[model samples]
Structures are given as structure tokens and as C-alpha cells.
Target: MAAWPWKSLARSRQPTDGGDSAAPGKLSLSLSELFVVGTWFGVATGLLELGGTLAAVKLMGRVTYDTLRTNWHYFWMTPLSNLVLFSVSALVLCVATARIPRLRTGRVVFFLYAYLTAWSLVSAIPTLHKTAEVVLAIGLACVTTKFLTKRRSTFLRIAPRAAILGAGLILAIAGVDVYSTNRPVDRGPSVASVAAVGPPNVVLIVLDTVRADSLTPYGAERDTTPNLARLAREGVLFKHARSTAPWTLPSHASLFTGRWPFELSADVGRPLDSAFPTLAEQLADRGYATGGFVANTQNCNAWYGLDRGFDHYEDFYENATVTPIEVLRSSRLGRYVVTSKLAQAVIKRAAAPVDFRYRKTAGMINRDALAWLSDKGDQPFFMFLNYFDVHDPYQPPKEAERRFTKAGGEAQSAANLARDAYDDCLVYLDSQIGRLLAELESRGKLQNTLVIVTSDHGEGFGEHGLAGHGVSLYRSELHIPLMLVHPTRTPAGTVVSEPVSLRDVAPTILDLLDLGTAPTFAGKSLANTWSASAADRDFSEPVLSEVDRADHVPAEVEDAPARRGRMRSITANGRTYILNGDGREELYDLHDDPEESNDLADLADAQEHLHQLRELMEQVTGVQENGE
Candidate 1:
């Protein structure tokens, strides 16, 4: 039987199959032992992974079990899932390796450096503990394969039944322990809050890839969001509203639950747990008719459960080429596997690319949304409408594209010039909003309706090393525009600059209608802001922003010893932390370098500020003593 890998790290009492002492006076293990260790490590890690993830479902939903088990699903993550997985794998490997006596003592120094590097990465993308565990397993396998001699490497050799039985017993105990951790309970009265409105109609519109500074009301260079501008001029606008996480899933999750991405699964790739009560869920329980109309394929994934609380969720790009996963799946393989593995493979390839590419212009999504809207019959509804026309593949209508290219933007890329098309789409969406408003008015429901318009974090336009969104947490990603067009009784033409978080939106809405629920929500209400003047507002520090990019593991080659690992970021205390894939930290003062063009790690004062911000960040992200 092959001895465990750790047994080979140094000499042990066990003899090698070769019957020869592998090394001199120092004890040594045969190569076969190493392979066994790797295999054992991999199997245990995979099981741990399954167990840990199950726990995540509970953690995210803040639930033990279901009352009826009607709709129990999976975990949902935002953008940095790959990064989270990588970090978590390291932590898992760390614990597993500690069991190896020879390997444990000999690689103390090496393990310390490795673990610190791993911890730094794991902390950034907090949800990927499973991914990290897997990576560690793979790491062991890789090392074992590289060192083991071909002599005993053949698969034909098998461990004796007794030894195999022992290993299996250990594994079974480990799995059971993990399973024991999950004690399913009944939160019969699952929720404690309800919005106190006569079921006032709630309309949440998320404009995908909309840049923060692009709208005229926000002092943009162009009149891109004229319709939104009109609404801002007459409604309440949150001047410093920031998204909790980048990308669609995480940001949207925050928007719905008023929580940060890390608090949930954090692996935007996985399915979200349904136990948590989102805003829509709350409203639905309150007897409001709920529905969702989404244009982005990213928002319509099964894992996200954006359709969790809605009764009628519409997928508009059905026959269109706009469905992101389907398009990618088709590109990788063929249409035959459009809704399967091919789609998933394509998504990773397209998203995690060397550079980036642009596809269509915006308006198509808006048209679909409008089509869906034309059929609505008001029943005090809670409807979510997300439009991705402003997102990349910036192909605008030819006329709009021509208008911009001919007027001034001819020098831009196909995607950029398509901005006109995007602008046109945004305009169309606004017009559609206006139409909806008119419809409500015609039905005498306009005055009582509560309209909230926001972008799910803004897009990046060639700012840092990226374009569009999903790269960093700068003003571009977190600083989105939010407007509340409530009943006139709530006030109007108000702009709140009070450092409001997307996490606070749910509480704010509940509070607005005098909903008798505890205001335990993370976001503060802008309802009162509608009655206050801009100068009277106190927004201490811009809204907090974070971009944990730990998962982008660069493809590496063995011969080339310079492949960097991954980077994770924390932006607070006026300094932006740039953690590189190579396990290096870079600090930049945003006040000094708005574009983040310089690293200020050596600045003593800057480091002091960084220290403070880090403190606040940990609290905001909720690192409780209870291990939440």
C-alpha cells in the first residue's frame, strides 16, 4: 500500500514497499506514500466542501429549515465566487494538513507563509471556502503526481481491505460531524416584519451597466438619463447610494435583502437559498401581487432566485440573442445544450477573459420590458423590472448609433459609439416608465404608487484596467443613482446625500408606509430626506465600497515560476487596497489618486487611516463573535 504523502516529508517508522531506506540517517517515505496522502487529502477535502456549503445555505437564509419544504434550493453568490472558492480551499487544506505529523513539523515556516497568503486571499472572497478547499486538494494531487516514481504509481495496486476500511471509517466520522452541525429547526413564524402600506404598488427598476456620472442630474457631461433626470428633478434622489457588491447577482441581492454580498453565499455562481425573506417576499406575504420582468440573462439564473418572491417572472429575451448563458453555451458547443454545461463553460470564458469584448447595444431589453408592461392589471403590485440595454454589447438602434457617431463619438469603439444606442435605450426605458406612470394615473393609482429607480451598481468605462462593470469597487461600481417617486404626501424634488447603503432600502420602504416592523434593516430611509434640504443632510464619508477579486486564478505553467496567485481588495479609510494575484498588498489614497494611479503603502499617515477604515469595514461586513 502507498504510504501517505506526509509520511514521506521525513523518515518514519513505516517501511517503504521497496524494503530499502529511501534516505540516509534521516528517516524518509517512499513516493507511493505521497500519492496516497494526496488522494486521502482530496477525498476528505471534497466531503468537507459539500458539508461547508450546506452550512452556507443555512447561514445565508438565516434559517434552520422549512415549514413545508415548498421551495428549498441552493446557494447564490455575486461576482467573486471563483475568488472565494480559491481562498476557502486553502483554509480547508490547512486543517487537513495539520493532521500529518512529519509534514506538519517540517514545513512549519513554509506553511506559515503559505497560510498567511491563503488567508489574505480567502478573507477577500469570503464565500469560496469550498473552492479553496478543492484547490488545496488539487494542490496535494499535483505535488504527489510530480514526485511519485512510476514504479508504484500504477493504479492496479490496492490497499488491503482492513486499511481501506479504517480510512473509510475516519471519512465517515468526519462527514457525520459536519452533518451534525446542521440541526434543522422550524422558524414557524419565519418573518417578523411587514410594510404598512395599503399594499401600495412597489416598482423597482434596475438599469444594468448604467454609469453613475452619465446622467445629467448627477452633473454628467451629457444628457444621457433625461427621463431619470426628470424623475430626479421631481422626486427624492440618493446622491451617495452605493451597491454592496459588484456584478448583477450580489448587488441585486443586497438591493432585495438589504445585506451585503459576503453575508450571503458570496459565490455569485451558486444558487441562492430561498429561506431568506427578500423585500418582494415580505410584500407578497402582505398580500401584494408580485412579479419580475428582467432583461439580463445574468439576473435570470436559477441560482440567484431573483424570482424567489415573485408570482409572475418574465424572461423577455426568450427568442432574442440576449440570453447571456444561452449565447455562451451556443458559442462553446451548439444550441443542443443551450441550458446546460455548455452555457456555464461559455459564461466563465467570456467573463474571466484576458481583456474584454463588447456585443450588442442596449434598447432591446427595454422594448421587451415595455411589451410585458402593456399587459399589467393593477392589483397593488410589487414589480421588479431590470433593463440591460445600457450594459455592454453596446449596440444601440442604428438610428441612435448614427446620431451619436455622426454627431461626435465616431472615434470610439463599436461598443462605445453604441453608447448612443444605449442612451437611446435608456431614453426608451424612461419613456416606458413615463407610460407606466401615465397608466397608473389613468387607473387613479399613480399618486399612491411607490416608485424606486436604481442601477445595480454602475458600469466602468475604461477607468481602471477594465471596462463595463465587475472589476473594482470604486465610485463607478458602488456609487449608483437612486430616486424615490413616492406619493406626493411623502414629498418630492429631494436629494439625500446621507451616505445611504443599498442595505437600507428595504427598511426605508417599510418605514415610509409606517410599516410597524422594527427598523433593524441596514439601510436608512430617504423618506424623511424628501422633506429635508440638501445642506441639512449629513453624509459622513462617501458610501462604503468593496471589491473582493480573489478568485481570478491565472492559468499557470510549471516551467514558468512566476505565475501570480490572486488579488483581493478592501477600500475604506480613504485608501484603496490593491491585493495582487501574487499575494502582495498595494495601498492607494483615492483623494490623491482618484484614478488609483499610485500605491501609497509606505505613507505613515495613510497607513494609519487604512488601519481605521479596516476596522469599520470588518464591522460593516458583520464579523460577529458567533461566527456569522
Candidate 2:
């Protein structure tokens, strides 16, 4: 082979006062050689840390955090970030030693790198206590550095070869990761027996974490969702739509399967199982092409089993494709650096266009969706789009922020600021929705399409002492907007006031399409309420919302009434009865006390209503008073 690329670096030597560089006690290395060695060592250490962490996560099967997921982008980003960091550190060390004659930069830098590498490797062993791991790493690194320094020539001989091997391995792994993640999803065979013809295409858009009351169509004073208001005017809006759960997975599970939350495998740590067929599966089986594009990658991704039946599903960092910033966000070190307070401050500055989080914007999602729609042929398609911008850590675009919220100042409380930002996000989401609708109209697809706009669940902004979803079954978290728009089918401007669960979404879609109800679905078709020609128009029905104690609740408040155990509620006859996890019962007249401040559980007149609701709940959910 041609001479090794690092031959000069390996042979390079430094002169000392004794002049004989080969002297046993006077081992020295040139600044350039030291620079190369230290930089490579740092890069190798980073790669080792990342590889070890990934291997541990895969082998253990317990580290299931979204960040640790094996996204292809992380492979390249983590090692690259480490390389940059280590190279810069090496440069700094080399410059310092050249300037300050007394500083033994080579040994100090090598020792520091060894210690850090050891620490990183040990940290991958999740079973070890952090203190013990650190101590062991330091001890090991000290011994290793001492041994190598004593045999500098031997170490120099091996270092270059080891670094080259490491570089090769990194490239190999990166290539493999890219190939694996980007490979086409094998959609074995088309389930459709015949191509769909006249049935209206279904476009279900879920505005995640959007509460009904916050939208202008739901009586909010602000015009935050003018587009939604227009859609409401052109569609049938369910004024009292409620989600079956207070969070994403379960609520979405209910929406897709037409079943209750307790009946599904979806939970804080678990994903929806195949026990129930999704709406997409039902449509796909009946000659409809299905596609799901979701921005809530944390829970709505394929990892969570939400992409079960879709021929194509797109989520954040999918297909081994990612932007530069997305790659940074996917890496462990880059995640820490990008999410640091200083970096966040810089990103959130008014002049900066950077997003605080690595979420796809609604515009981006819409563009992808529209492109997919363009490719769809004569086969009626069922498309599911989830917009996550309205969820947490609200950072709205500059224009929307200016339009909705007052300038950030000391006068605005934290809650006010958060709510304002949330509204800003809603406005941005609405604008995107408007754009999607306009695109559909321009393409002559709007008239033949059945557009459904709703949410998985609502967000809680200090309502009923709840700040976010999944913590409680309060109205703030359960009440979501539901609207259906179809040119020739659904009656425009029709407002249905009856309480309905999101479970009805699947059944209603099937019912309107004349597909009938699936055997497993527990929800009733909502067509009866909107279709005048139907025999039974009575819309009165009990709506149930359930929530299990979420894992994110702090330990200090684990026993808090709202955060304890499982909570369930049933709304019927304009009254809602809540069975709290702590064995407390609450009853509220939703018509008169929509705020749920007045508890009628102990009232003599309310006992009869509570008893009836308890029976209804037990009959519907098969769970008794003590929450079996």
C-alpha cells in the first residue's frame, strides 16, 4: 500500500533540553503531532460514547425516550459535533502551549481527553450509579494516561492506526443507518378490490392541543382562527365535541378506532396495538388510498403505531432526511447545546427565524401533504394531517405573534404570555389550514372531498388548576372543536349542540360513506343528527372522557388529587359527573356552570342524577364506582 496517510504525523518528534529525544524520561511530541493525536482521540471518544449509548439502548430495550430513538440523522450529527468540539479544543490547547512555555499541554490535553472518554463510555452503562461510574472512569483514565505517557513511542505508533480504523467505522455505521431508515416501506399489496370512484375523499386534519373555547368559532372574542370560523360557517360544527382522553395517543386512538381509551393499549409508555383496526385500515381495505402526515413526532410517529395502515406516513426526521438543524437537534450533545438557555435565547430573539424546537411547521407539513395529494390518482384517498405547532412551548411566528399578542413586557404574567403565544400559534395554524383548503379548492378537489377538522384533545392553561393535558379529565382538556365540511353531503352552517365523544369520528366517516359500522366500534354514527331524512334524529347521548395518571407529573405532587390514579367522567342530560382518582366525586351542570366551579356531588337533588350517571358509566365502560 502507499505510505499510511499519517506517516509524517506518526514520525514527528519534539526536541527537549537534553537534546536526545529517544531518552526514556525525556519523551516529547511536536505541537502538530500532538494536535493531530488529541483531535483524533477526541473524535474517537465521541464516536465510542455515541455507539455505546446506542448499543445499550437497543440491547436493554428500556431506554425508549424519543430523543434516543435511532434516527439516521443522530449518527452523523453526534460524531460530527464531537469532531468539531474536539478539534477546536485541540487547537486551543496547542495554541496555549505554544504561548506559555511552562504549560505541559500535550499530557494535560491527552489526560483530559482520556478522562472524558472513559466517563462517556461508563455513562452508557445505565445500571451503574452516576457517582460510582464517574469515580471508576476517572481512575481508569488516570491509569490509562499514565501507562501511555510512559510508552509514548508505542502509543504514537498505535494512535494513528486506531484513529483511521475509528474513522472508517463511523463512516460505515453512518452509511448503514441512512440506508436502513430511508428504505421504502414495504406496503405488501393493495388491499382494495376495486378503485374507488364516486365516494368523497376524506381529509382529516387534527389540530393538536387546540381547545374549542379558544377558537373564534367557539365564542372566543379574538379572531385567532378566522379560517376555522369560515370553515365552521361552511360546515356542520359540533358545539359540544369532547375527546375520550385528555392526551394525544389515547384521544387519537379513540378517534381512529371508534372505541374508548380504556379499551385500547395506548398509554404513557405503550402504543396503540393491533387489537382494533384503525379508520385508515378500514378505508384502505375498501379501495381507498391512505396517507398520514404528522408533525407531532413524539407520539404521532410510526413508533407509536399511529401509522399502522397508511400506505405512506411522514413524521419528523423520517426517510433518513433532515435539515442541518434537525440533525443537530437529533444528536445528544447537539440537543443539549441547542436547547441550552443561551441558545434558546438566541433562537427566540425577535430577529431570528429559528424555531425553539425541531418540529415541522404547518406550512412545511401542508406542502408535503399537497405534494402527496397531487400524486393521488382516481382512487379516493383518506389523508390524516396532524399539526403540532399549537401544542406546548408555544413559539409562534413573528407576524402571528404581533397580530395576536401584546409586545412581551413585564406587565404580562407568565400565564398571559403563554396564552398569548398559544393564540399566536393558533393563528398560524389557521392560516396554514386556510392555505390547504385554498389549495384543495384550486385543484377542484374541495367539492368532492369531505374535510374534517378536529383535535386529539384540548390543552389546559391553568384552567381547573391544570396547566397541560394528560393530567386531568377537566373540560379544558376534553372539549375540542369538531367540524365536517362536504359540498354536497353535509349541511352547511348546521350547529349540533348535543355532547358527542371523539370516538364517533370513525363511525361517522364510515356511516357517511355508507360503509356501515365496524363490529368493534362502540360509537354511534353522527349522521342521524345532521341528516334530516334519517329516521332517528335524537342526538342526546352520554359522552365519557378518561385519563390515567401521566408519568411526567413531578414526584412531589404525585399524590395530588388531579395527578393520582385514573379519573373518569360522563356527561349526559347537560350534567357532567366526575369520579376523581382519589375517590372524590364531582357533578357539574355544564349548561349553567360551564366553568365546573359548582360541585353538586353532595347535593340531595344531585344524588339521583349521580346515581343514574354512575349506572350509565358502568354500563358503558364496564368499570364500577371504585374504578375497577
RMSD of each: 15.5, 7.7
Best by lDDT: 2
- Candidate lDDT scores, in order, read 0.51, 0.75
Candidate 1, which segments miss by more than 4 Å at Cα? 1-199, 319-378, 398-402, 407-425, 517-520, 528-542, 549-602, 623-628
**TM-score, structure 1 vs. true:** 0.56
Compared with the true structure, what per-residue lDDT tens digits does model 2 show for residues 257-370? 898988988775566778999999999999888999888877776656678889988875443465555555554445656678887787678456674446677887898787
Prediction 2 TM-score vs. true: 0.74
Worst 10 residues of 2 by lDDT: 1-10
Cα lDDT over the full model 1: 0.51
Give the TM-score of each candidate.
0.56, 0.74
Residue-level lDDT for 150 in candidate 2: 78
